[model samples]
Target: MAPSKTFFSNFRLSNIVNLLLRSLQLVDGLVVIGLYGIDLNRARKEDKYSDGKWVYAVTVGSIAAATAVVYAFVSVFMHYRSLTFLFAWDWVLMVLWAALSGIFGTMYLNEKVEMEAGIHRMKVAVGFDLAGLVLWFVTAVMGSLWFFRERWGGRISRPGKA
Candidate 1:
């Protein structure tokens, strides 16, 4: 495709996708943090915050949001392609979100367990946590696409080639 000479046209399609996904990441992180932060505060008041699941959820959510902000600055706002290293970090973030979602999911899905009264909130958190995982996974896939397109250069050699 020929490059267009317009303000919005200057940006690549993938970059636009990254921007939208990063926006979703920011929102998912904030929602997860808000969902758990209130409980975290209450737990702290009750002296259980240090060992509470809410603490972990809030911390991971905060990190996800912070990372999304920086990534958006470098990748979208600066009009830079996906940094190769971000692929690894994206996987790491995906795993963290997966863990968060899995833990909450089990709590929310299991009907036989009567563990905590707070498990009721896990239903909402599971959705946002899973959303975080999906967002990071999509970012990682995009980064991989960039890497393969730029670095792989899949040139096949035939046996008859001299």
Candidate 2:
């Protein structure tokens, strides 16, 4: 959906991070489809994917939607606020985490697709999964904390006193 004017007003650094996370998921989903060899003929004829492909599509699609929402929120936020130190840090971290996840996840998917290639041993695939999981977890936790802080945390000061 196109962003609304109010979206600009509610921008937050955390929103941008969420945006990156979602985008990565979208790309990952596409990679999964390609790597797993999507049955385009079946999809077109049957109007649905094969067993596993459907799951990947739904999960990745959800992420893409969520990312779009974050994009809207961040665009709105940026409208009201300058790109200050906090904003820059948030963007940098978000991009870094997303890129890391993409790299490892792509490797994992590619290896899974071409098991006969033998370039990535079983042990190596396990390592890639572990690394991807770590990055995903860390990014999720940080994004959630930022969301909570922006949505709920605020100074509760005594009235007219410090």
| lDDT (CA) per prediction | 0.79, 0.46
lDDT for residue 15 in candidate 2, whole number 0-100: 55
Q: Please write out the lDDT profile of model 1 over residues 7-92, one tens digit for every residue.
A: 45647777777778888999999999998887777777998736557788988899999988888777654554646557778888
TM-score (C-alpha) between model 2 and the true structure: 0.36
Model 2 spans with C-alpha error above 4 angstroms: 1-4, 38-135, 147-162
Candidate 1 accuracy as lDDT: 0.79
Q: In model 2, how large is the Cα lDDT of residue 72?
A: 44
Residue 96, candidate 1: C-alpha displacement in angstroms: 0.5
Per-residue lDDT for 100 in model 2? Answer: 39
**Local error of candidate 2 at 14, Å?**
1.5
Q: Hey, what RMSD does candidate 2 come out at?
A: 10.1
The alpha-carbon lDDT assigned to residue 97 of candidate 2 equals 39
What candidate 1 gets wrong by more than 4 Å, as runs, is 1-10, 111-119, 154-162
